[model samples]
Target: MATSNGFGPRALRYLESARNLVGCAGGAVGLGLHFAGLGGVWWPGVVAGLYGVGALLTPAPKPRPPLPPRPEPRPEPQPLPPEVSAPPAPKPEPVPAPEPAPAPDPELVALAAYLDTVPLPPSAGVDGLLAALRAAGPGPVAERIVRHRLPVAVAGYLRARTWQPWAGPDDPDPAVQLGREVDRLAGELA
Candidate 1:
């Protein structure tokens, strides 16, 4: 029988029970007729046996219904009219030019000149080198040293002045190295 909410497992069970009952009634009627002499015993037995076998072999339950078709996705919405569209692109601001580096210190210039007069090994002593550095003052010269733009020999001479415990007499003399750096710097400057 049809149902308002569609046939369910309970309906299937009831139908299966009814099918079994019909098979049993048919078998009983065939036996009763045979006993009453309406048909031969073998004939009725055969009919009842066929009915019972058919009932046993027949499938009762149905397969589940196929899953519902999936809904198709909607397309993306189109852009709005120009009047309601995004604001006009912003103008790019101008970037300022970088400042030029300051000219080299005048004292450093004069120190290079003085170094030119001094011979190799700096007979004037370490005090003379210190004096030249003092004349150049600390600011610009220190910046050059920090940046490592100074010649390697000059850098080595400056480092030697710090007199770490590791430094020894066997190390190349700072004066000789300084002389080489002076020659290089003077040639470049000239």
Candidate 2:
């Protein structure tokens, strides 16, 4: 028997076999001796019988078949050339510029310029302007200017102008300043 921790490759192969021939042989010899009525051999016979039964109870090792050789890889296919070059894309047409806005009504422009000259108390607010325009007299032009909403800055300037006392003739008139703004806006419309 091989010693523990020192088994050769052959010893390993023997262990892997399904049937333990050495144990079977030992059992057969033991049985023969027992049948021959040999004295003082019963213990060895029993041991051998048990060993053979244990070996028979053990499962067999399965044998693995050798793997087949791998096949050579195939070459990749080359890309085919385009049959013909594609036609060039069409260019987009240029868009026409929008026509200038129509000029503002002359009457509205004149009314805005006229309203710019009107002076009132600071407390008047925009309502005061509207009231003044109404008091000026009932006309299509006055009505239009009264109905039109003044820009915030223009309204604020008008209100501030009301708070200041009448300036010297040398100083610039607030009305004239306001009229200039109106002209500028009217020019833009034109």
Candidate lDDT values, in order = 0.59, 0.58
Clashing pairs in 2: none
Considering only N, C-alpha and C atoms within 3 Å, which residue pairs clash in candidate 1? none
List per-candidate RMSD values in Å. Answer: 25.5, 28.5
Off by over 4 Å in 2: 1-7, 16-41, 65-71, 76-190
Q: How far is candidate 2 from the true structure (C-alpha RMSD, Å)?
A: 28.5
Query: Candidate 2, overall lDDT?
Result: 0.58
Name the weakest run of 10 consecutive residues (lDDT summed) in model 1. Answer: 118-127
The residue-by-residue lDDT of candidate 2 on 80-179, one tens digit each, is 5576656668998999989866555554456557656756334424344444544455455554454453454367567657765765657666655655
